[model samples]
Target chain A: MSILDYILGSRKKTANVAKDRLKLILAHEREEGGPDYLPALQEELLTVIAKYIPVDKNNIKVSMERKGDFEVLELNILFPDQH
Target chain B: MSILDYILGSRKKTANVAKDRLKLILAHEREEGGPDYLPALQEELLTVIAKYIPVDKNNIKVSMERKGDFEVLELNILFPDQH
Candidate 1:
């Protein structure tokens, strides 16, 4: 399929493509380090933060990006204001 | 300030905190790799894709994530339908 077709056609396939691409990039990134620790870190963060506030563990997103000279690890968590 | 305060305070400061946290995490990631080449890759991708279709260069985002045993490289580009 064409790039556009692949991007707009099946959502599952599109997601897979994105995931595959990210894997390659991350492999290169990890080479500079050893192994990814984000998963463990995310779990720890959730445990610690949930102790103080109600959070949606299922929706929490933790990722990383490179900006200029800095590498940025992004964290997004959803929690109800009333909770 | 408390974590909640930092998370909910001035937008600029909140952003700074997130950036700082990400920096620390990414520092560990980059230890596996020497240098990041994503910026260069993004530019090249823009040039190649722009040749085939009109796209918003400013909105294109290239990022990476680790999932299970795979590392995901995500590419997001916005283009007008008419173009």
Candidate 2:
């Protein structure tokens, strides 16, 4: 192991810890939102958008955030200068 | 303003701060990793994969973490039961 690895722990172990923590955080988020809705909406939107122009899934983001009285669903897609 | 908003600051203001902080963090990360490479690879991979099956852009995460000797690029895509 390198000096950095010794100081910071193995990358795989750290990644696993991060992955587990992410699962817990996502579970909490799922409870706040519905379990499947965000993922479902993201998928459906990608399918619909892909038919017309080229879809860059990595740049396509769907997010739902709560305001005072209600919630808002926001979609963001980044298209390259050429595309 | 709600009590929570007063305590936590306005959501829009808080979001702006968070966004700015995130930009700084991403800038640092980009300096460590190549600036344009990771995002470009992520976009290209998403484009190719979207051609075949339905894609969940939100769940499709591409990350590169440096190991001791090398770096590993990881792509994670979530597919549900229904098509």
Candidate 3:
């Protein structure tokens, strides 16, 4: 599916996984862009995720990976100290 | 102020911190409750924060601290590999 499609599509549903999840997908253009755009995009993506999913906020875990023109953000809502 | 106050009050305004922010505050009852409540509360809080803020979602960072009966969730929208 297209980037926009991914953003607008329904999230894969399943039973509680002992943790909440925040997933962010970013698409970049091949043309020239500011260096800061990637990180800014990353931050904005997190913000969007934060607003939707409910987590301790303090206990939330964020992980990221970047490809040619796509970035993925994985938010883990699991508490480390407890389990 | 009281626990309820913190939850309902306005968030302190500040400039873009080169990162987005997610904060969760949890209050517990004095009486007995399920042991799972704390982590559950944490997850819910992160979900709420993710929904409200815009971030790369993939690159988001989550931190948490607990004291007494209160838990604080601090979400950082900073990109680790980038910045």
lDDT of 3 at B78: 35
Share of the reference A-B contacts seen in candidate 2: 0.00
Query: For residues A1-83, what per-residue lDDT tens digits would candidate 2 score against the true structure?
Result: 32222223423343332210100001101222223343444465456445533466676555555433323333444443331
Which candidate has the highest DockQ of all? 2
| lDDT per residue as tens, model 2, B1-83 | 32222223423453331110100000001122222333444455356545544576765555555543333344545443341
**Under CAPRI classification, how is model 3 graded?**
incorrect
Stretches of model 1 off by over 4 angstroms after superposition: A1-33, A66-71, B1-83
- Candidate 3 error regions (>4 Å): A1-18, A33-35, A57-59, A66-83, B1-83
Local error of candidate 1 at A63, Å? 3.4
Global fold similarity of model 2 (TM-score): 0.27
True contacts kept of 3: 0.00
Q: Write the per-residue lDDT of candidate 1 for residues B1-83, one digit (tens) a residue.
A: 22222223322442332211211111011223333434444455345445544556565555555423332345554434341
- Candidate 2 residue A32 C-alpha distance from true site, Å: 33
lDDT, model 3, position A5: 29
